[model samples]
Target: MGTTFFTPNFQTSPVLQGPKTAYTKPKTREGQAMGNFLIDLSIGSFIHHLYSASNFFKEMVVLKSNEKCIMELSRWLHDRTGAYDWKHASTVVAELEDKRDQHQNIEMRLKSSIRQVLKCNFEQENITSPVELPLADCVVSGLLLDNICKNEDEYMKNLEKIIQLLKPGGQLLLFSSIDKSYMIVSGERFHSFKYSENFVKNAFDKLGLIIDYCAVQRRRSMNECNDYKAIMFTAAHKGE
Candidate 1:
C-alpha cells in the first residue's frame, strides 16, 4: 500500500526483475518503438519499484510469514475480472509451501501465499510461456508473460491473455495510475506515468475487465518523502 515504483534495477528487488531474454517487444514499427513517447509516459509501471526502501521490507516480512501470506492470497478471490492484485500481492511466498500446507482445509492459506508471490503485475496473461510455476493456481502461472511483456502492445496482449488465465468463475483485481508523479532511486531522478483515469478505464474496457475500487491520487503532503500518489484499483474478473 506504499508508493510502488520500478526501474532498470528491478532485478535487485527480490521481486520483479528488470529484464529477461525470453520477453520481447512486438516486431512491428509502432509496437516495437512504442517507447518513443508511450514508454516514457508509462512511468506508473515503475512507480511500484519505489516501494523497495519503504513498505518493501514489510512486504518482505509478509512473504516470510505464513499468516500474512494467507491474508494476501485471500484477495485473489477479489479478482472478479480475472486480474490479479499485483500491488498488494507483490511479496508472497507460496512456491516454497510444504505439502502439509496443501490440504483442502489449509489450501486457502497456501493459495493466498502463492497468489501474493505471483503479483507480477505485468504477467496478467499466460502468453510468454509456461513457467516452472510454484505450485499455485493456473492464473498466477502466466508469470513469464508478465515478466517479458514490457512494451505496451505486449502489455495489452498480456492483459487480454489474462482473461483466459482465470477459471470460469475466478475474479480479477486490476487497476491503473493517474496524475504525473516523480521518485528518486539509486540517487537518480525518475517520474511516474501521466495516465488519466479515463485512459486506464478505457484500456481495461478493451479487455472487458471491471473496476471494483477506484481511488485516485490526493495531495497527501508535500513534506512526504515521495512526490506523487495517483493510485487506483481495478478488482473484478470475467463476469460470465
Candidate 2:
C-alpha cells in the first residue's frame, strides 16, 4: 500500500511533485473573486484554492479539525521544514490567473489573506465553540465530511453545521471523494463514506443551496491504498 501512493498512476500519485499532467487545476471565478471573508474547513493540507482565493478575499479563516493538521499547515505558514511544497500547485494557479510570473506574489497574498487558524471538532455540536466565528462570504471544504462521517445521515448533519457558518447568499466550494470507502494517510487507514454525484446534489438541494457548478471525475488509474473511484467538485451558493 505504501508503494501505491506515488506510483505512475494518476489517481495514486501525489500531485505535489508528481507529473504536471496528473494535476488538474480547477477553474476559479473570473473577473473578480467575491468574498470578504473566506472560511476554509479542513482544506489546509492542500493550499491550491488559497492561491485563487487570495485574489478576491481580504480575510481567510482556516478551521482545522485536528491538531496535527494545524501543525502541518502552520509549518508552511512559518516557513519551517517538513511542510509540503505547494509551489507547483500555486504556479498552476498563477497561470490560470494569467499571471505566470506572479506566483510568488500569489503566495504572499495567501499569507496575508489568512487571518485565523483554529482547531475544531467536527463531531461536536458546535464545531467551533468558545470562539464565535463570523459568517463568511464563502466556504471551502476539501474531503472533510466524507472521511469522518459514518453515513449519509451524519454527512447531512455536518453539512447543515457547515452551512450555519456561511452568510445567506454566500457560496460553498466542496471537494469530495465519490464512491470511496477508505483512504490511507501516513501509513494509517481512514474511513471514507461512499457517495455518488446524485447523493451530493440531493444533499445540497435539501439544504436549499443553488448549485452553480458540479462535476465528478473518474480517474482511469487504480491503487491499493484506497478504494476511491472518482472525485467530486461542487460550487454552490446559498439562497438569499
Candidate 3:
C-alpha cells in the first residue's frame, strides 16, 4: 500500500509550538541570499509557521501529499468562516516579533503571501512530477519524514528528495521528532520512523547541507497521543 497522509485534528501540541520559534530564529549561512520563494512541506494543517515566514519571502507555496489535504488547506486559507482559528497563533507570532499591534491582521498577510497550493508525494521518485516548480529559496518541513519513512534508508532518500527542491545555498528549516516510532491520530496509531539527533546531523552532512543552528526541546509534559522524547529544530543551508 502507498503511504497515507493523515491530518490529525489536535492542534497546539509541543511540536506545533516549536515552529514558531524556528521561523523566528532560523540562522542561515553568511553571504547566502534568501531567494523569493519558500515552500512548505509540513504535515498537518497548521499555518502558525507561515506567519513569520510570509514577511521574508515574496511568495509561499504549500505542498500536500494528497488532494484531500490540499483542498482542505486551500479552504482553510481562503475561507475564514468555520476555518480553524489561527488568531492565537498569530498573536504569539506578533508578540515574538514585536508586532503585537498587527496580530489581528497576520492571517490576512499570510494568505496574501501564498502563491499556490500543489499536490506533492515525497516518496515518489520525482516529488514534483508532471508539474514543474521553481526551486525555492527555502523549504520548511515539520514532522514529515518520520511519519512517512518506514526506516532510516527511506528517511534519507526522502530527505534527499526534499533537498532537491532547493536552489544552491538555499536554506532548509526542519522540525522533527527524535526517537519517535509512532503517533496516535484520532485514536488510530500510525508509524513514525525512529532516529536520533546524530542520525539527522549525519544525514544533513552527507547531503551537503551546512547546519547553521539546531536546538532540541525535551518533552516536558506527558501526552497520550505521541511518544516523542524531544522536538528538534534545525536551520541548515546548502552550499553554493
Give the winner by lDDT: 3
Q: Give lDDT: candidate 2, residue 183.
A: 79
For model 3, the superposed segments whose C-alpha errors exceed 4 Å read: 1-33
lDDT of 3 by residue, 106-198 (tens): 878899999889888875777977788988888989888888899878988999999999999888889889989888877899989999999
lDDT of 2 by residue, 58-96 (tens): 799888987888898888887898977778877876776
TM-score of each: 0.39, 0.85, 0.85
Measured on C-alpha atoms, candidate 1 has an lDDT of: 0.34
lDDT of 2 at 95: 71
Q: Over all chains combined, what TM-score does candidate 2 have?
A: 0.85
Which wins on lDDT, candidate 2 or candidate 3?
A: 3
lDDT of 2 at 99: 88
- Cα deviation in Å at residue 80, candidate 3? 5.5
RMSD of 3: 7.3
